[model samples]
Target: MRKRDLEIIKHLEMFRVMSRDDIVDLHFKHLKNPIGNANTVLKRLVRDGQIEVSTMHSPYLYFPVGNHIKKNSTKIPHYLKLVQVYKDLCEIEPPTEFIIEPQYKKGLAEPDIYCVFKGTPLFIEVQNSIYSSKQMEDKIKRYELLKQSELVKPFPTIIMITNTRYAIESDQIKVIQTPSIAHLIHKANEDSNTPPPPQPIKTNGNITFKL
Candidate 1:
């Protein structure tokens, strides 16, 4: 198998789902005519049964061959959100050191985005749905245990990108709504003099800001 194709498969397995543009941005951006080349590569992979495509959505989605392919499962808001964050991180100057999803360790809690910059790990969770109080408490406790345990040295800051207006009570977690990629990248590159990302605005009969 080709090196780039192998990387694409690895990404599909890790991220669970992706779009053509996602694949292009991650792997082929440096190539000449990236979009066209990405299309050709994806078609070849699909023909070889190395990957499968889903046409149920507007912009078709792609997944590895062994994974279950269902129309309903094809669209995940959280996955899309992560992809957007990934794209934004890629644009940061000096670049993001690394972004990954952690494996399920014996005593470690898995986070949505395990982003590393300057050797610091930021455990980011993109919460699209509201969790009950008990659920929230249990999750916090798990992270707390992970922090106290000798699993990860120095631990990592947990940032929750939540959809609701929640007032959390955890010293280990920071909650925010609708965060920009630049802001996140800046957080990782603390000493770097990158300016703040532009905030988003809404237009519904009147102009408003997204906070």
Candidate 2:
């Protein structure tokens, strides 16, 4: 019934599931005894039928009431990763908008996350496992098609986070392949700060000024 409790439920509804630590870190970390406080509030929610808990995983996972996802669903880990990604981005700089698994037109791109950070939109693909070259190519092609369609105006830059680097290039849309969002943002900042390469001096008989 507290404000933070309501926000936790909202987060569950949006993210589908979150580990106990994730909830505590995001909501109760300000308290002197964060874990204890979180446990108390979460237990009350579970007792009142406001949320569901899965004890199968250590540091039990919590889900919104009426959630259809099975306790053992393989997608549980994937969603948890998204929650971590969201948390990381928040630490760097909170995103103005963040959506999970944004749906696009049929046969178009299916981005894992669509977020606006620092006034720029980004479509992120969190690859927990290595994707084959062909699979990567197919994914890029879908984004190209989506760009051509122009449904999402000011098309977002596509960022692929994977441990196994895949050689992916796209002219229609900017693509950044990195292991994490922090790396991507840091690289972008570095690139922006880098000075332009020196231009070659053109000497037409009497011209000696820098071009």
Candidate 3:
């Protein structure tokens, strides 16, 4: 930074923001002999190319010539935190190129982690909501589509993982369903009288029916 540029920054850092009037008034308070105006200092900085006058975010704020705050909070961004939790629990590492908002024709589906497991691609959606029928239907429909070849193969195993802020376990975790698709379909349709004929339920000879 130029000698004067550094001095200006030290002044700006004193608060979240500063206006020309504030700086001019501060000048009078500091030097006791005011330049009597802020334009002089601003124009000087502008001429030296130490700062640029920006009018985008706020009305006329001065910014460094070409610097930006790239890095942010270490705690995950709010939108990704829940998704990250799913990845952590599932022990599934998401691909770097995976789309956070993967495009699906039916709706705006935001899978927490669109990654592959055991060479099979999967779509994991997380719900931090109190379970509802509509939410349940939406979650299962994706699976039904996958089952009927209505969707694509290596068909994304829809993982609907839920969280109960409290430890008392209930029917929250839909992501970890039984190994068999038939059983999963059965449980999914258990609430309704007629679901449909069970299709093929491929398994690796072992399944978890705990739910």
Candidate 4:
């Protein structure tokens, strides 16, 4: 199997589902013709039985061969939002790489995405709802407790991306609202004094369709 095909399978197995556009954005953004190349690859993958597609939605979604996608499920919408955040991060310049739901030996806490930027490991959480003061405190406490144990060397920067305008800040964590995903990425990059990523060069010749 090709490396891209393997990556797609691993992503589907980890996230359960993703739309065609999501896949294109996340993996092929650097290509001269991203969407066109992605469509060609996806078609070949579907024909080879390595992946499957669902036409129940407008843009259509792709899934692992053996997995059944529940289009009507409430969880799917939230999952897609998380995927979008991942996709947006992928599109950012300077090329941010992420590990989904990191595993720790200390406990069972799994943050949505663990990304490292400018040598800083950041735990990013996507919050779709408001949290009570107590609820928020408990989460902070849990992270603090984990840090104190020193089970994971070098404490990570915890960042919460939320839909709410209100935010929380402390020595242990920082919360930023999600007015725009690209803006959020730019803010983080600026705060770290990291340079923006170079733009992809547009091809003047005919775009090749790779499968």
Scored by TM-score, the top model is: 2
> Between prediction 1 and prediction 4, which has the larger lDDT?
1
Per-residue alpha-carbon lDDT of candidate 2 for residues 1-211, written as tens digits (9 for 90 to 100): 8898899999999899999999998998889999999999999999999999999999999999999899999999999989988988887788999999998899899999999988989998899888888988998999999999989989998888888878887778888788887787788789999988766666776545453
Using lDDT as the measure, name the better of candidate 1 and candidate 3.
1
> Which pairs clash inside model 1?
none
Q: List the residue pairs that clash in candidate 4.
A: 94-197
* TM-score per model over all chains: 0.72, 0.88, 0.35, 0.71
Tens digits of per-residue lDDT for model 1, 9-79? 98888677888889988999999899899989999999999998887765678888887646476346568
What order do you get sorting by lDDT, best first? 2, 1, 4, 3
Which portions of model 4 miss their true places by more than 4 Å?
A: 29-36, 68-71, 93-97, 105-108, 165-181, 188-211
Candidate 2 vs candidate 4: which has greater lDDT? 2
The whole-model C-alpha lDDT of candidate 4 against the native structure comes to 0.72
Which should have the higher TM-score, number 2 or number 4?
Answer: 2
lDDT for 66 (candidate 2): 91
Candidate 3, poorest ten consecutive residues by summed lDDT: 69-78
What tens digits encode model 3's per-residue C-alpha lDDT throughout 1-211? 6565575665444222344444454444456444543566677887887666544433245544553422232322333343343334333333443334355556434455566644656676555456666666665555554445544444565654555322222232234533332343456567577655555553687543432
- Overall lDDT per candidate, in order of appearance: 0.73, 0.90, 0.48, 0.72
What is the alpha-carbon lDDT for the whole of candidate 2? 0.90
Candidate 2, run of 10 with poorest lDDT: 202-211
The TM-score of predicted model 2 comes to: 0.88
Predicted model with the maximum lDDT: 2
Candidate 4 per-residue lDDT, tens place, 106-155, comes to 44346777777656677777777788877776667777766777765677
